[model samples]
Target: MFFRFLFAVPVIALFCLPASAGQYDAQFRQFLKSDVAPAARQAGVSQATLDRELKGLTPDTSLPGLVGPGGKGKPPKINFQAEFKSPARYFRDSQFNALVPRGRSLMKQHASALSRIEAKYGVPRRIILAIWARESGYGSAKIPYDAIRVLATQAFMGQRPEFFKGELIAGLKILQNGDVSRTGMKSSWGGAMGQPQFLPSSFLKYAVDFDGDGKRNIWSSDVDTMASIAHYLSAHGWVKGRDWGYEVFLPENVSCTREGPDNRQAISAFVREGVRRVSGKPFPANEVNQPGNILLPAGRYGPAFIATENFYVIKDYNESDAYALFVGHLADRYGSNKGFAGKWKPMKETTRGAVRNLQQRLEGLGHDVGGADGLIGFKTRRSIGRDQEKNGFFATCWVG
Candidate 1:
């Protein structure tokens, strides 16, 4: 009876374990076979490749923001009470200071290759270096997940599985392309692959074999990575011999409400309106008659700029005004190493819920709050400036 009790205890413990832990394993395999295989095969993936890669594949439930099968598992609401930082926090000097030396070193190290890429692609070596530093910390950032697994899991259960489904097929095609082995194709949890962090589709379209190797290996080749980034920017219309934009002193007479890509005026026109480069130099002679739009990122409360069309091209790399500015500013610092001339005014920390409430109020008043997504975009900033102007007050265009 003592021996029987011991065996029974072990059996009971085994039965008590959570079934949900590997609950999706069978379902995930079936999904790969039934759902993914047809599309991947149609995209020229072979039977052996599918059978090899899909074997024992299981969804990684631990990945953040997953929704379950058929939407039965409701996604958790975003924690709106989380602290929302001012845009100024993103431009901290310490961040730029740390990146400068490393970028300049890479510029010298890869000078020959970067020179070639620039002659071919028309993107500056510094801009390429800044993007490289920002994206992967010059390839030091740990990208630890398997690209195949990440694409597979996200396709199965992540918030945008349909979009990931397409990327998953693209990823398999990349595998079929023989550029990198499955083991070597490391990625972020979101499946942005390799040092330049090209999505699998971007890899197919823009990745280049700069080293003259048969394969476009962005994973371990500095030449391929740098060239690939240049190619992407160039394809997206990076104009040669142009800086992204210039920081400027916006006089009080120039209304902050005039901020946006749509409100463009010639550099000469801006100079006529009393906008001066923060550097106190004249706007570049070549750009004087060229169009520029006012970019008041923190509204009138922060440093302002007259951004050129090249600034929007950088925005194509990452769709945020702050992101483009960081890349461009960092690129400039490699030459001069100076921080922004204007100050980011001190502001109290507020919750995203509070910001969302403000956006909702703006929306109710028929202002475009850029979808009330709790994050402030240019639309929200301009609407605030317009409202402030309508109320017969100086328009700060930023949150109080």
Candidate 2:
């Protein structure tokens, strides 16, 4: 039986701290005792569990914004052009293709266990394999940080406290259940653990024991790991037969601003606006009724995708649109297509600090570039391009 809980906290009274340098080990301990301990107790976590998992565990001050002295002076900037243009850097087609045979072999290795899981739950095998390959490189990758320390840091010092606080408690429960040792509860910076990179809260809800060991162990057990991934997607409304989405050609006159998910005009509406599917194929009956949004991931230069409801489902797993595109494209590479056909434009690769400085400078000049968030989303890029045009820079009107 899978136990799922959705603990939604309103985004009110949450304090945002600037990235500061200092060791908060004492403060962190105080936070655990005063704030986290009571909350964990209310959520039914035993005192024994808290001591076993969190006692003597120091906070990881090396997290993104919490780096100590001798580290780089400013937060790292995102180099958009370099990231996108060099396929080897980010999108390695050949290396990704090589994983297909390995993925198939692993799928076959766990076939019996996966078969039992599929019988009980209607989730498909390929989708499970796709998620497995995309996250942690089919279980070959190692999760790097201590889960509790990472969660606590994010909760106390990082941006989203309420969300991370719930996850922090969920992680303690995983330790209490004896599924993982406190020492072995390693995970990503954001506290996503094990083979499928599940956030601790997500693991408690969606993890399953396919090996029948009476414990849902996702760290080392392939059977349990893959089944847990399958269960997660199935719970989150994954339709088996439908493609995640498709690469399509928009008409020359179709405004690129209408491409974001927010402006998801109905397919029929887009069709009326001279937008045609790139494949020259008729829309599937179920999909035509479903609204599709345009995504210009790299502004006007790169490939455009008409994302379906499933795309949002993928985003639920990882919020970044670029990450979703990478996963979807990686899956496509393994299954069918070689690569996207769109021509990419070159843009300056600015570091996170540089982008923030640029945004501040542009805003000072009344360009209305969104707040100095390091992420170079479409709005930021457009604002940058407009400023560049005014400043007499070689304006291709692209944002990095």
Candidate 3:
């Protein structure tokens, strides 16, 4: 599910005139008429729908990450001055403990429907529940914004206005289809709507009405929401009978630089090289012959994993490795209610700027740190490891 914090362009700045708060209403209305209406109309939305939905609509300038009227403000920074937390904090056992009981209960409550959903979609119920808890606290999280207003506001003044422009049109199309009322179509400030937190585009493509209620009502229907999330994962190529990953013990002799999807090999190969499940159980027979890759989210300073192709499939839901790992770990806790056996070792606190400097240094030596983005992605982590090996030190694959 994409978080749609939407944004806008410059020549159109002339329409803003004085660009004051009061005038923003006038400007937004103009934008709807001039920019949005035609695109929405071309996409089969009626003139009546346009006039009715857009009448008196105004921009929400208070939304975070806006870049001013014409997307002219500097992009938001990563708060480089703040200390980056370790995985121990991110993957707090109390946090998972609190979530697991509810997840287990929901699993039983929805067991029948979930079974059918799993049968149809080939996605496990546990994974679906984990994603549900993560996305919107299993529909308990409030999603209170008018989706049209949020999308329209984003299209008018937020960053990535063109992207939001498309989303705004899609939002209008959702309204025109009568799948949801304009008033009932609540979204986050960023425009990810309903329980599954689907963007309008995602709703159109993947949402399913499993409850037979004639609406893919992610807002209030637990069954529909669960099925919709399952449908999303299935569509994204979630492999049946495969686990996302396994917590593992990586031998000290193995380099952490071997992390990432591109470095995948048979799980059997990893076991042959001395990787073993922290549980001491063998890799599942179904998984042993299939491909897997090293995954050290905090490099070697945290728990080690041998992630499957299914792990990357989960990542397709949300790009962050931490997010995918969290979902996988949470799903596991449904059965065992245990945390990772391997510990997340402590490291010195460092700023994003400091990390970026390290990344830049690695890039200077012709290593690809994935554009020196300051965030330590797999490329950065592995680059650090490779650099360490080059300098005759043990490769930790992390920012020291």
Best by TM-score: 3
Local distance difference test, each candidate: 0.82, 0.68, 0.84
TM-score of 2: 0.73
Segments of candidate 3 deviating more than 4 angstroms: 2-21
- Which tens-of-lDDT digit does each residue in 166-205 have in candidate 1? 8899888888888989999988877898888888888899
What's the lDDT of the predicted structure labeled candidate 2?
A: 0.68
Q: Name the candidate, 1 or 3, with the larger lDDT value.
A: 3
Deviation in Å, model 1, residue 383 alpha carbon: 0.5
Ten contiguous residues minimizing lDDT sum, candidate 1: 1-10
Each candidate structure's TM-score, on Cα atoms with residue i matched to residue i, is 0.92, 0.73, 0.94
lDDT of 2 by residue, 292-387 (tens): 887766656567778876776776776656556766776666556466766555545444556668778777877655577655565565665566
Worst 10 residues of 2 by lDDT: 1-10
The better-scoring model by TM-score among 1 and 2 is 1
Best of the candidates, lDDT: 3
Deviation of model 2 at 193, angstroms: 1.0
